[model samples]
Target chain A: MIDPALGSLGAQIVLAASSDENHPPENIIDGNTETFWMSTGMFPQEFIIRFAESMKIALVTMHCYNVKTLKIEKSISDDATDFEAISEKEFEHTEGHLQTNDIPLNGTTATHLRFIVTSGYDHFVSVHRVSVE
Target chain B: MVKLRSRCLLVGDAAVGKSALSQMFRSDGAHFQKNYSMTAGVELVVKSVNIPETSDSVELYIFDSAGRETFVEACEKLWGQPSVLCLVFDVSSELSFSSCGRWLERVRAHCQGLHIPGVLVGNKSDLSSRREVETSVAQEWAQSQGLQYHETSAKEMENCEAPFLSLAQLFHALYQDRLQTIQNLA
Candidate 1:
């Protein structure tokens, strides 16, 4: 998770049960994982690079007070070498927005934007989900 | 076959020490730390404790959930299955305590009119001198809402045992009552 406003970034890796019924990995990143925290602004680029390298699968959700602050095109392109951006509307009822951009990388698709805020004066970005493939 | 125990849900605002409190009660030699960036979803930890006067041990399925506004809907879904609820807040931060009312309201609405016993936990009591919310105010609020309340610090381990222990006792009594009612019907 990356909180731009608070300038903090964290990562957790857990042993998750395999989705396949026949065979499951000894461990998977389901629920149990260690948590790490770092200042987001202090090491913005390094934070993104370190997270991408550490996990086999990575999902990135961008949050900002203003949608314009997202810089979705630049952030996604810069973070993952191989990625696809998709617009999704499934969380419309829960999020109060009809469409959000989904970024998929490392065989995992970032499905949700946990929070988004937009205003004339300030913009903030927070990433809520990331999974390693 | 392994039988899972009854579950209790812990709901609160972010950085309020819900995770730390859960670790202290469930994990030994627990240290204070904060790295939960939007609980992603619900995290479950299972711990077994022997009641003081009872021979049988109870397994607690504790769910430490995300406290972000965006996850409110997801939080609501999880609250439906809980047998009990622990509403936590940070005593040093008044905003967190105030948010408790919002959380409580949402939980009640999501429960579909079912009344589940809830306890308000004012965590981080070690920093009492720096406190923003007074104990009297919290107690009065809890009383008005008819919810049990406590002040605890997961860091200092103050009153940490009371909240969970009391809730466990309540669960035990409720379980026995239900059993008796079933027997009467039979």
Candidate 2:
């Protein structure tokens, strides 16, 4: 098991629809649950994480809140585009506590993973931490 | 352009209208989000406030943090030594007002003995009929804590700018005072 999202691993957040100086996309992989990246206000917010090298990922654990529908995609190309659908899940509504869930990819080989929050239970969604293995 | 920057922390209990007031100030009263979404983590917004009689302005980087206790530890990591504090509470909820002490203590502890200027904001002032925290009571508490007090109604868009403006002015004053001290040494 390995945390490919760590900065030491060279995981980079290539693109984020909304950017807040204090709460940037870097928080998603910072291994801290207290810090998070929040959407400005809109549906269909997406972010792409590029790994240092292609690896077979079996599971992706995410700690988030207000996320209703999450779609995961993967890409092996050098560029950020051309991602293929890997897994999608509808998260259960939670309050007061965080919504922690894991997505199984079944040993899929890819260098990049994209997470799209298509909808949220509230106007804003927060992604606390993401880790892959 | 003689611009200054400061990190303002907005912290309080859950559902106390911090987000609404911040959004209203950020949008200049052009936008007010009515949807109630509890902040699970910190939401940052930046705005520039121009001093009335001077060409200088202050850029406020507001850290609107989650109010829930479950996320406080994680939230504190994001709040890196705030320059000012905007502690908010609901006027209609006594429990919310009471929690201000704990919130203040948390922020104070995180500051590590730094003198951070701040304010106590009684939000949801439009709900005067259901008010649980009296103005005098809030004011006394604020005075005891060395923080200015203000009341606002984010729903009605009344006096939403006072708290932030006061903070900016206070920060600018501090900057001016420090500059004078340095000049005195020279």
Query: What DockQ does model 2 achieve?
Result: 0.02
- Candidate 2 off by > 4 Å: A1-133
Question: Could you give candidate 2's per-residue lDDT for residues B36-124 as a string of tens digits?
Answer: 98899999999999977987677889999999989989999998767789999999999999999999999988665667889999999
lDDT (Cα) of model 1: 0.52
For model 1, how does the per-residue alpha-carbon lDDT over B43-86 read when each residue is reduced to its tens digit? Answer: 88777655677653446778888888787677666654455678
lDDT of 2 by residue, A1-133 (tens): 6698886779999998765455688989988877777664445789999999988998999998778899999999989778999888999987667889989899999989999998776545678889998
CAPRI-style class, candidate 1 = incorrect
Q: Report how far off residue B44 is in candidate 1 (Å).
A: 0.8
**For residues A43-104, could you state the per-residue lDDT of candidate 1 as single tens digits?**
01111222322322344432211122221211233234443333222222112221234444
